[model samples]
Target: MMILSWRRRRGGHRTTKAAFSEENLSTNLAIPTHFLCPISLDLMKDPVTLPTGITYDRESIEKWIETGNQTCPVTNQVLKTFDQIPNHVIRRMIQDWCVENRARGVERIPTPRIPVAPRDVLEICSNIMTATQRGDHKKCMELVEKIKRWGRESERNKKCIVENGSGYVLSALFESFSSISIEEHKFLLGETLSLLIRMLPLGSEGQSNLGSASSLRCMAWFLKEKNLSSCQNAVLALKELLGLDEKHVNAFAEIEGVEEALVKIVKEQICPKSTKASLMVISHLISSSTSSENTISRFLELGLVSMVLEILVGSERGMTEKALSVLDTICNWEQGIVKARAHALTMPVLVKKILRVSILATDLSVSAILKLCKSQEGGGDQQVEALQLGGFHKLLVVLQVGCGEKTKEKATELLKLLNQHRGRLDCFDSSMDFKYLKRPSL
Candidate 1:
């Protein structure tokens, strides 16, 4: 055994390294237990020592803490503090071990960059403020790039950047640059928007700062950008801001081509997150606006109904819930209902989603089907289609499995409507078993 020791610290704490030799290394080329992170059981890279005297990889420990876990992973003891001290000695030992085992294909771990502290983030924010005040565009861009790098380094760094007030600073920069020519500041604007999106769930102050009409227009402009990330960020940012109040939602709806832009994003399927964000923004606009009828009409003109049904056919749970929600809101208007009922996939997709997604999704799906079946325009056809699509069985299953009072009411009403055509449709059998349908796990 190769004995290794270190001097004792003033607190009477001693640090020791694992002792290993060639004979032990050749046995299955085993890794020393101490070199492995307790959390991941992988060789430690950037090991950090917790107050519990247990060492873990920095990324693993930070993620554990960020997820609301306060207890040590190995010891199960409540952590007194979240501070993680770098275990330089262990990191060096791991590096040396990797180097000695290079012939055996062991790769060395690179040194980790020091994590940004709150003070470092605050200093960067200060520089951005000063640069903006001086109209030093070059200096501001440089600092923005540095901030972006820090934001991408780690979740902890991103949290530090956000907690240190980067949201307000970035919003101010975004608004200030909105006045410039698009060609002149397009890159900076995109970067600023990207950083802002990273600091989402912006506080009241940040939302207030970004809620201006000019800022809303700027965001709309980004929705038309050719860059996918910028477009996604723009819609996501709008979703967060508009959700804060009815006034913001109403204001955003008034922007020219806003509905068209959102419709295009959904139709093109820019990405799932962006598509969902756009759906949410549309839901807020139609559901919250004082002039909802006009807003719904505008969305219908932009082909919103068809795009939403296309999404519902293949979307996962969260996306399906959002799309169904938007469809339900849109169906409040006569034109919206007519457009939805006209689609071939609308009834089938709505029925397929029932009891398949979460309770919220089931509620939205049932609500949309209810609106389509009750509408005066082609309402009979919709009810007939529901009966043909096995919606009757799903509605029965919905009631048996239990749902919200409102959902239960909607399901009851829908079942009544579909039952009117039960004998006319061959899909419903008199001897069918209701006890065999799959129930959603509670």
Candidate 2:
């Protein structure tokens, strides 16, 4: 036993020396557990502490804050600020550990770069605003480029820029874009529009300012850009600016090519996110009571009903829901009802999504079908179409399964419309399932 123990010690020494050899060192070194961050489970080179007294690596914590979490990961307490104090002691201790283990192939952590301060961000933004107000396009562009670079560096810098009034400055710049007629200024206009998009998800006040006629028109120009990203950002910014206000909605509707641009964006299918944003903008515009008759007429002329039906078929839940909503709004108008009734796929898609999406989607589909069914001209043809497209079975299912009061009313009305024309279509007998069609509540 003694001989075997001595041989084991000798062999361990040989193994350690072999591991230290240049060819195999990388595989032998182990990082200390204390140096790893709790959130990422990796080495924490730049540790910082939150108000909740939890220390995390700077990058991870900043990203977490950027995602709009207000609570600390460890304590679940409200985070007063995303601004975390550097955990200098822990960072130094980690560095020292790396140094002590350097002979064993551990690499030392480099010093972290300094983050942008809020005061500096405020100063730059103030200068940009001043240049913008003075109509000094040259100086404004230079400073904007610098700030854009800083914003790209880290989310911390972006938060500082936004918190320091960069949103208002960008909005003001966008508003002034129309007046700058110089060819050089046109380039700045595109860059300014792109920057404003990056500044979204943070500024309601800036969005309100951007809803002005001139500013909205400027934003619409980007929708025609050859670069798909520019067009997407332009649409996204428009959607974000379109808060639930009649004034904003009306302003959007008044833009000349807004409807056409949205249709083009949807048809191109740039991406699902961009397509959804465009749909939302169109939905809001069509739904507004303040929108002019010309706007609704324009949508119908642009084949909006068929476009919405195309989107509803085999689309995502969100797309289906919003498309149904737009359909329902358009159907409210006489022209809209006519266009929808004329579309071949409208009733079929509407019936297909009745119980499949959500309660809201189901409700919108039923209401739209009812409008089509109630139309004076070609109402009988639409009824026959609905029954032929299996709407008869779908409506019976909705009635039997039960839905909201409004949905049930629309379903019952559609059934009555279909029954009145059942003899013409020659499908179901009138007495087949009369019990399922209960009278809707008043």
In the range 298-343, model 1's lDDT, one tens digit per residue, is 8898888888888788778888888889999988888888888877
Residues forming the 10-long window of minimal summed lDDT in candidate 1:
1-10
Please report, in order, the local distance difference test score of every candidate based on alpha carbons: 0.82, 0.77
- Pairs of residues clashing in candidate 2: none
lDDT string, candidate 2, 346-424, tens digits: 8878888889998888889889888887788877778888888878778878877758877888788788777766665
Minimal lDDT window, size 10, model 2: 1-10
Cα distance off (Å), candidate 1, residue 376: 3.4
Badly placed stretches (over 4 Å) of model 1 are: 1-109, 180-182, 418-442
Stretches of candidate 2 off by over 4 Å are 1-43, 47-110, 182-184, 198-204, 400-403, 423-430, 433-436
